[model samples]
Target: MFSTILVPIDLAEPESSHRALDAAFHMAHEYNSDVHVMTVVPDFGMSIVGGYFPEGFEQKALDGTRQRLDEYLEGAVPDNVDVKGHVAHGSIYEEILRVAKEVGADVIVMASHRPAMRDYLIGPNAARVVRHATQSVLVVRD
Candidate 1:
């Protein structure tokens, strides 16, 4: 039985995210596992985009995202499940895998949206995570 489950969500996509969270919650209940819910913030440190935002934008974004994650958990997470929220910066797929390893997740549960042309060329974060993750992954399709 799994001891820890990770669910990575995109806050912009509520429907798919909730579906993935539900899957994680179900598994957590069955296995008595702790749930790690994470969302990645794009790294804006690159020279081009960095100039656009004013100073402290990264900290502000992180604070807002952390609040949103906490609010989401209050409503969505079950009372009995042990849940922790994490906010990471940089490439989504890489941060997810890094967090999964850091937290020692036994399985990763995440959603996959309908693929667009760009996904074929670059692949979606879900696909990349699936390919790179050492732990088991459950892709909940939307």
Candidate 2:
């Protein structure tokens, strides 16, 4: 059983996040674990690229994500479980791993729209985590 699990939510795909969150919440309940929900922004990429975007771009993006997560959590997350939402700036997979480490997650719970050839190779964010993460992973398919 997992003591800590990380669930990465794509704000843009808020509607689809429920399935992932639900699965994570179920697992968390089974193990009495905490769920760490996160959304990754592309700001880290822009900063690394060393360029300024239009005014309010970053804030707008962050705000949008906050709205998405808030909207999704209205009736999703459980009261008995611990849930934390974070907004990070960087690659989704990398940020996911970083948060998993920071939260000391024993298992990483996530979702994938589909698996293609790319996934068979380097794979998606979930796949990458499965390959690199020292802990276990539970990937929900949609």
User: Which predicted model would earn the best lDDT?
Assistant: 1
- List candidate 2 stretches off by more than 4 Å: 44-52, 118-122
Which ten contiguous residues of candidate 1 have the minimum total lDDT?
42-51
**CA RMSD per model (angstroms):** 1.1, 2.5
lDDT of 1 by residue, 9-31 (tens): 99888889899999998998888
- What value of lDDT does candidate 1 attain over all alpha carbons? 0.92
Where does the lowest 10-residue lDDT sum fall in candidate 2? 43-52
Model 1 steric clash pairs: none
User: lDDT tens string, model 2, 1-142?
Assistant: 7888888887677656878898898888888887889888865454655455676777888888787777667677767777888888777788788888998999887777787876678767777888888888888888
How many clashes in each structure? 0, 1
Clashes of 2: 1
Clashing pairs in 2: 119-123
